[model samples]
Target: MSLESFGEQLRRAREAKQMSLGEVADATRISLKFLQAIEAGKFSILPQAYIRAFIREYARAVDLDPEKTIQQYDMANQEIRATAEEWVSRSRNAALRQTKERTREIASLPVFSQRSVTIFAVLVVAAVAVVYLLNVGSDSSQQDDVSEIAFDKVIRESEAATVRTESGRALPTFEARDDSLRLEITTIDSVWLAITIDNTRRGEYLFAPQRKRTWVGKEQFQISIGNAGAASFKLNGVELGMLGNRGVVARNVLITRSGVQKTQQ
Candidate 1:
């Protein structure tokens, strides 16, 4: 059977068992929308990790044989997987072969004299030392006048949830700051501002529309949320939190044992 057909069959079996989409979602902790997508045969909408997990959950929830359903799915998609694997293997082999050829070409180059190599090494070390000293001197000089370490990076804190930027557009990604944090805000309409610190909901206030709000911090935990704007942040690859329209804002913040000083605007 075709992969699409297999997905359809799975959906039929699930419905025949009188299972609601939300029930499966609740049991699996997968989103209701994602569960509906699976039932609709829109398997491509799911990430690979969730696809298999969804299938397992669906089967188990309907009392169908999970192994059989998975086997059928594998059979249906075997050709696609095999073709993809073949392409990946060929690409890897080609890259490795090219690397070996480049290595051979470099090895065949004329060798420098021993004295020339020694001078090059000395110059390289001097250049590195100069770079290190310049960076250190610049940092030290800035410390006296700098109020805070200020930098802007995208904040991506959730895998399944989307973050809205100040532009009223969804951000595909976000960045985290190690030295300090930045929170930028703007409103399409006069609305309330509610933010959370370290996943704890903070205060709320009325913010006028078309105005920009900005916050600067050296704190470990940071988040800002409002009804009229978008908010998101990241610490490395992990998402810190996501803010959406309506409801009290809940955000995650990382704190050291000594605790972190926080600010909101």
Candidate 2:
């Protein structure tokens, strides 16, 4: 029931609901700084009278027990509402602490935003560089490329069935009434892999074809449809995974989320 323990419980509940601090703040219309202070057990950072009020709002936002949290805080800090002298002492201490913190922050402010921007830009550049390297290696004759490569071709057979959209056609893929996800691939010139799901990527299935197969993630999963090359794949009419060798038909891949796959008895 201590402040520290209450903070831990609050954090756990928030995380269990898959919420970020910013998400909570945005949903509750609360300030992020104050929310962080609450989570950090820096109750003195807020006005004393506002502490319980803030805690109540935060608990409601996160679906925690507000009254229980306040009771715990009171039990932990029994002298929380003592005489005027104690209140004065705590208030003065909190004010002095905030002043020192503000001074330190102002002194360090000049390069802070610049550093953050530089770091973010660097991360973006690094991501682009990695993708460029992958495409380059695929175009070249590199054997060690793990990044997926894609090649596109039209499917004359599927042209009659696919429902065309701006991005691509929506061809019927398998669906299980009991499961929330499904993946199915079919093709004539090459294999057409399809993965349609109600959830974001919870897993993947790897089918290493004999030739290099091109796999791509569009709405779900996609692969190249047509082409006589040793490697080709198709999903929803888009060409994605490509392989190199000439006379191969299929390959084994690691499928993620093992039990989700439907097996016919």
Candidate 3:
């Protein structure tokens, strides 16, 4: 079976169920473009790590046996392999897409807060007072000394007040508990990750080099990583080294408060 034939089979299965690509995409939360790519036998459109997962979801949506479908896909694509450079390129592209999406989301946020405006106003008033004092002291040496002392006092008082305000607004520290789990991911290169927290909340992220993110879960975390060796994990502050070799795909890695449970590659 060729890759194109495999994709055609999947397409036929979907058509047999009378389901549109858009409907499948909505149901599986897979991108429409990815669904289209799958049907078109364009597996290279996605990271290698995600291809199997996406195929499994697509198969399930079309009422096919996900594992069986995945097996067929693997068999069909045995001759086709992605190089390390290709993986790096795909990861970089995914990171760029994620960055653009995040940029759009951040652009919608409020630019300035009331507290920021208040602080700016206070700084402006302080600057004006300092200038007035300096001009008044320009005529005499004694006045200059007095002005310097006043300036220093003003700066100290302003800093003290700012510190007090900041302390009042500061968020409480987080103290990790026995039951909670904290998973921190740090990326050394562009990588794609899918994470499920407590088997409930799921999210997919594309990270650029030198990025760090943390997630908390009560029970466990299930994660899949593309470019596994390019990223490191810390569970409750205990470092778990790279999941696999460079450009390798790691799937269904389980992590709990105790430590990394199992890593599947």
Candidate 4:
């Protein structure tokens, strides 16, 4: 059976059990995004081991035989692997043919004199050096921009910490809030995140390294991190640190005005 067919089977079983994706996520401790991906037959969303484990849990949640479901998944996955291998082999052969044709074309070209070749090489080196120096200058400018942004952020946060009310009374940042929660996320590496605000607004985000974002909620925030160590969290301007070790996925991390509640995956 195809992977999509297998996914449909799981979906049908879940429907028979009258289980929503969120219910399965709650029961299995899996991310709702992953559950959606599984039902769509997008096993490439996670590593094979995690996929297999999630599938097993999903199967059990819907009262399907875990081993049998896994066997079917394995058969589908094997078919996909075989297809990918065939495509790779074809690509390799095509690349080899192109390389050989290019080699023949190069052989048919007139050869340059040693002096001309040496002059051409020198010109190339000079061009490369100029490009390198330009890139270094650009990098230095970018670093300066980043440093300025960081400095501005520090100043803004410091000023925000003690804001004056309309009556000219200085109010503490936390005390001024009336049951509002703020979450600040900074990415150290490329990562995927699923965020829920006040249990009403939900969003999925993919962030590149050195990205910063903030979200506010009236009551709480729920977050799922695809690469836990790739992101640092701050709640109400207080650093919460990394979610877990590198390459680890963390799910059902709840945060409120009180504190962070972490669920180990």
Candidate 5:
């Protein structure tokens, strides 16, 4: 007698064990429809991606060797795989032949002649030269503008370095000394100001009317005021005079232990 197919073997085993499809379905918790399809060998009717799991479940329910049954199923489909391979081989050979014919036809078509190629190369070179000359001219113009801007910046910075005083009355200058310097600023009115001592920020305060702030520094003290006329200064307890013009912002005042000096504009 001929050996049974995978589905026939499953059916025979189930019958020998006297287990109905419904009974196996309930036991395995698989759908009765899918179980029937598995036994019928209509694996496509079930989910082809999970056909192996279905078969395994069915085989186990019937007490058949799941691995052996799967091996037999694979053997049964070997002929189908061979047939598919044969078709794929034929299709690939046909496609390769068509691609070669298309390539040969393209190669046979005329491309640019030597004279056309020479003319095209000359045009490309001319275009590149024109672009280079334009870029060079633009760079030169930019450099000139940059030079003018740099000159203006230098002039502005020189002005900023000088202290602006009323009527050009010569402002005092002090020599750098290592001794301690003390500054006393008494606000005539409320003045917003920032003070720095020895290159470190001391404080920025909005002094109340008539309020006085004093600081002693080892190296130097720098003060900036929002309302110059609102404050008066004393260096080492010697009154220096009016700090600045009313409503005018004084950004720089150089102070040293020797004396108080004016910063350049």
Candidate 6:
């Protein structure tokens, strides 16, 4: 029955639970910034659906009713959007006024003759041909790199062995055949992983059993496994075996031209 803002209500609820923002973040896996935004009524900082999700998580963390909190958040959002629409209408009116003042003579320019249009089209075609030739030359350079390496054979482990971080453990090796390394993975069980191919963060995603994920890397791959025994991996078509046991966590396993190796933590 309280007529307070959604943020105020949530904030009061959180305070009643006697918890800090960081504690809520740790419990819900929601970032502190998002938590702050939620408590500040900065719903515009996040997508509407995500704001609702944050509200639900925050409510759960504070032992508040998620449905009630989400309802309050939705009402508050509708009000905010309504005000935004009013502002947009006023801005549009001002823009129209300004537009009417600018009666520039853009149509005064001479139109292209039929012969001039033909010449312009020809130039555009020539430019496109130049771009195509440049791309083909770059592709040829990459092809030359593959030809330098021998794919007639692949280097692999003598047996399915666990890759280790210790200095004495042998690392697997594969010949670099192109501008990038091709990595193929198949989930053996329900697994979660974080993948970075050539330093690009592909993000953490869940994979069901038998799901295949293929990635390419120009230099190396950085992979973290939530369940090591849940996935089978291949480097350029060479089977590398399962990573580890069930429920095992592998952080930043490195894959490069030299081979697959667990990074030294």
lDDT of each: 0.49, 0.45, 0.69, 0.70, 0.61, 0.61
TM-score of 5: 0.32
Of candidates 5 and 4, the better by TM-score: 4
Lowest summed lDDT over 10 consecutive residues: which window, candidate 3?
137-146
The model with the greatest TM-score is 4
Across 37-143, the per-residue lDDT of candidate 4 in tens digits comes to 89988775444545666787789889999889999998987786666556555655565565556555555669866765665566556555655665554454333
Report clashes for each candidate as comma-separated counts. 10, 29, 0, 0, 8, 0
**Model 3 global lDDT (CA atoms, 0 to 1):** 0.69
lDDT of 1 by residue, 130-229 (tens): 5566555445433322122220110111212343433547534223456555555555543333343333323233343354554334443343333313
Q: How far off is model 1, as Cα RMSD? A: 18.2
User: How displaced is residue 8 in candidate 1, in Å?
Assistant: 1.1
Angstrom error at residue 136, model 2? 71
lDDT by residue for model 5 (1-265), tens: 1113667778889999999988886555455656676767765432222356556667777888878876777776554445555655565556556555655555565896676566556655655565566555445433312243443453345334433233545444444354557688887765555566776434445454567767777777877665678789888888887657865555567787666677421
TM-score of each: 0.33, 0.30, 0.42, 0.49, 0.32, 0.38
Give per-residue CA lDDT, model 6, range 1-265, as digits (tens).
Answer: 2213778788888889999988986565455666887777765443333456567768888998888877876676556555555655565455444433332222233875676566556655655565566555445433312221221111112112333323535444434556668888888765656666666434345455567867766788887665677798898888887777765555668888777877421
Candidate 6, residue 85: CA error in Å? Answer: 0.9
Segments of candidate 5 deviating more than 4 angstroms: 1-179
Candidate 3, residues 53-131, lDDT tens digits: the string is 6787788889999889989998777534333335445555565565556545555668856765665566556555655
Off by over 4 Å in 4: 25-37, 40-60, 63-75, 87-180, 208-210, 245-249, 262-264
* lDDT ranking from best candidate downward: 4, 3, 6, 5, 1, 2
Task: Pick the lDDT winner.
Answer: 4
| Residue 64 alpha-carbon offset, candidate 1, angstroms | 1.0
How close to the true structure is residue 167 of candidate 2, measured as C-alpha lDDT? Answer: 48
What's model 1's lDDT at 166? Answer: 36
RMSD vs true structure, all candidates = 18.2, 24.2, 23.6, 12.4, 36.7, 16.9
Candidate 2 local lDDT, residue 141:
26
> Over 4 Å off in model 3, which ranges?
1-33, 41-179
lDDT (Cα, 0-100) at 163 in candidate 3 = 19
Stretches of candidate 2 off by over 4 Å are 79-265
